[model samples]
Target: MPVSRRDFLKMAGLGLVGSGLPATPLKQIARNVTTDNAASMLYDATKCVGCRACQVACKQRSGLPAEPDAQGLYETPRDLSANTWTMIKLAKENSEISFVKNQCMHCLEPACVSVCPVVALEKLESGPVIYHPERCIGCRYCMAACPFGIPKSQWEENLPLIQKCDFCADRLAKGEAPACGEACPTGALIYGTRGEMLGKAHARLASDKNYIQDVYGESEVGGTSMLYIAGVGFDALGFPRLKDDPLTAITWPYMKAVPAVIAVMASLSTAIYFRTHRDKGKQNGEEASDGSKD
Candidate 1:
């Protein structure tokens, strides 16, 4: 059966590679202890009203220009873009409505961090996935690797840069919440430690039996700093149904192994060709010597 785009997105969200392999362990390295802690966000779609105030706040905080619509009115973006770091998507199933906020998932084992050939993206000690434009060569590989499609490029600019949510690292350092969380009128977006957020997500799922039993990000892509609680299946909200394993994990081993296999084949081919030519040369030389003697 052909996988639909919606289904593909779900798989992407779950960190499933296109190859359909099971989830694998993400590479994680421990960092030195510091007083500063990792920060995260918890998004409850059931509680979101899609007011888009959070979107406005994000633009204001990030100093991004307003997105104008056909009517020249400021409109919230439907997806994450260079000028829009956060977005809200609406989903409906069986007459039930859900609002899903979209942004960088900030994976515990971030594929972007692992795939960046130039180390443009880094998983910071504070848990936010930060992008260093200075190191970026505009490859946009991070955008391709991200399950959530969170990273954006300034395509219009001559010198493009990858853009995504930083979990408000600057604000967090000053003991401030992310603009989106602070702007959420219904407390739909909450900022805190991953542990605390996971606990809260589980509690919500437990208390609200109707909610999807799965916590979108708990183990997806080896987990994400931003979590979600959805009333409808995540698919309806544009969240891809990903395999438990990250896409990067599923694809990397094959990529790494190909070169070694090619090298071995090349070596064998070279040896065979050389041996054949050497034998022919020896036969020709011996025939010439015999002819000369005769």
Candidate 2:
């Protein structure tokens, strides 16, 4: 009474059937939210004066603590972190200098939202990619999936949570602008509908001779809620050069195969366990029979 190759195949098939993977492949699932009236932000790099008003406003609105330097004299963070949601980075190319505003791009088809196993990250129809701490399993997949490297984990805590800009979804719901945009004294940061922002970005590109020809986020990674226009090349301003295709194209195939692979492995493991124990039991019975004859 040994298990045959046919029996093994049957077991594998049953495991696949019981895995409960969705009927629709992950690639087929809708990734892009309707963005016609979605909340969006536009940053004009030429207008930014490196005042850091937006950074301060962001911290105040989010109730985040300040990060002090080695001397503990002042809060000057070099990059985004759990406490620092956004920051102004100064990039210098020869004598010319440009202040780059760095934060979550909040892509139309967010890779972070796509990769989260627990649905802890969600892309709202209004354009913010918000995080749900209660639903989070602290997987940190969203941090890795983001092309902009926006999400930061609170590593100090026993149970750390991911943190990043949510485009001020609460403010958007209240029909108010984001704190960062509202705090900009130079009118560098503009908040409006995605359509309106795109229009303004395009208009500036056409009207201003000094501004770069390209709109940074209009088509990058299938577009983003946050857009930028700069006087110098974006590369000089420390912007990542990304393709127009959505990141979901790259992640979906691997995600889709996970369940099937798990099922096959489970079935093989089960079959091995049963076969090993069955052989041991049969050998024990044979020894008992021989003893009776003696």
Candidate 3:
């Protein structure tokens, strides 16, 4: 039997029931790790001189290869990729230029962690979004779920994997700061506890009238480990103005009804099957009566 458009949509919505993620937004499932003791990174655009030392340090520490542009002599990359975990993205507004460091936000309630079918992506208690490639099936669902678009796939490799900055989990475990934080000479990138970083970000904004009133990443997507304090507008600096609520909360209600959706689809499928069978039986009966009458 042919399926109607409405039935197709019902089946599609039903697929969410077995999608490996919870239907309801379980409070403690992914949100148990709070920022109270979590390590965090703070980027102050006002203090950044755009030296790109942090960029070099990320490659050196991770042992990732450099990605040169069309002119192979330059290692300048426009955005995050498989090789470049972190890069200084330039934001231009006429003559004045601002530098924004793009990396994993490491969200407190990370959407990647919530959506990963294989549990490959995890949010550490130390405030880093780490990936386990061995567990990863290269699904790329994490890439779609992430609001910051931080994860990059190693598409060129024979045995490819997705890569992103883990906030230097190795260094953090050893009680040292991340390579990018260590390499920042102007104190632009600071590594510390999440609470302490938030305090500093707020303090700078309060002390300096020149700084923008808003603190990027403080409450974006229910807050992130990485925070930003910039003098220029966040939009002008290419920062996305996002709602404070986690994406999970926004979509969970519909997700919770997936079973019902699936039930409706199953019933519809059965109805279609029986109806076609009945119609075929009636046609056979009509043909037999006509032959008997002749």
TM-score for all predictions?
Answer: 0.77, 0.77, 0.77
Model 1 error, position 245 (Å): 1.3
Ranking of all candidate structures by their lDDT, best first = 2, 3, 1
Q: After superposition, which runs of candidate 2 have C-alpha atoms over 4 Å from their true positions?
A: 1-33, 254-294
Question: What is the lDDT of every predicted structure here?
Answer: 0.79, 0.86, 0.83
* Global Cα lDDT for candidate 1: 0.79
Model 3 misplaced regions, further than 4 Å: 1-33, 255-294
Per-residue lDDT tens digits for candidate 3, residues 174-228, read 9999999999999999999887888899899999998888778878878888999
Q: Indicate the worst ten consecutive residues by lDDT in candidate 1.
A: 28-37
Tens digit of per-residue lDDT, candidate 1, span 1-294: 144434554575586554423323344333222211468788998889999888888889989987778788758465789999998877788898888888888887788998899998898877888888889999998888787888999999999898898878788878899899999999899988877887899999999898998888877756778888888998888877665555566567656678776897999999998887877977788779777755
What TM-score quantifies how close candidate 2 is to the native fold?
0.77
Report the candidate with higher TM-score, 1 versus 2.
Answer: 1
What is candidate 1's CA lDDT for residue 24? Answer: 36
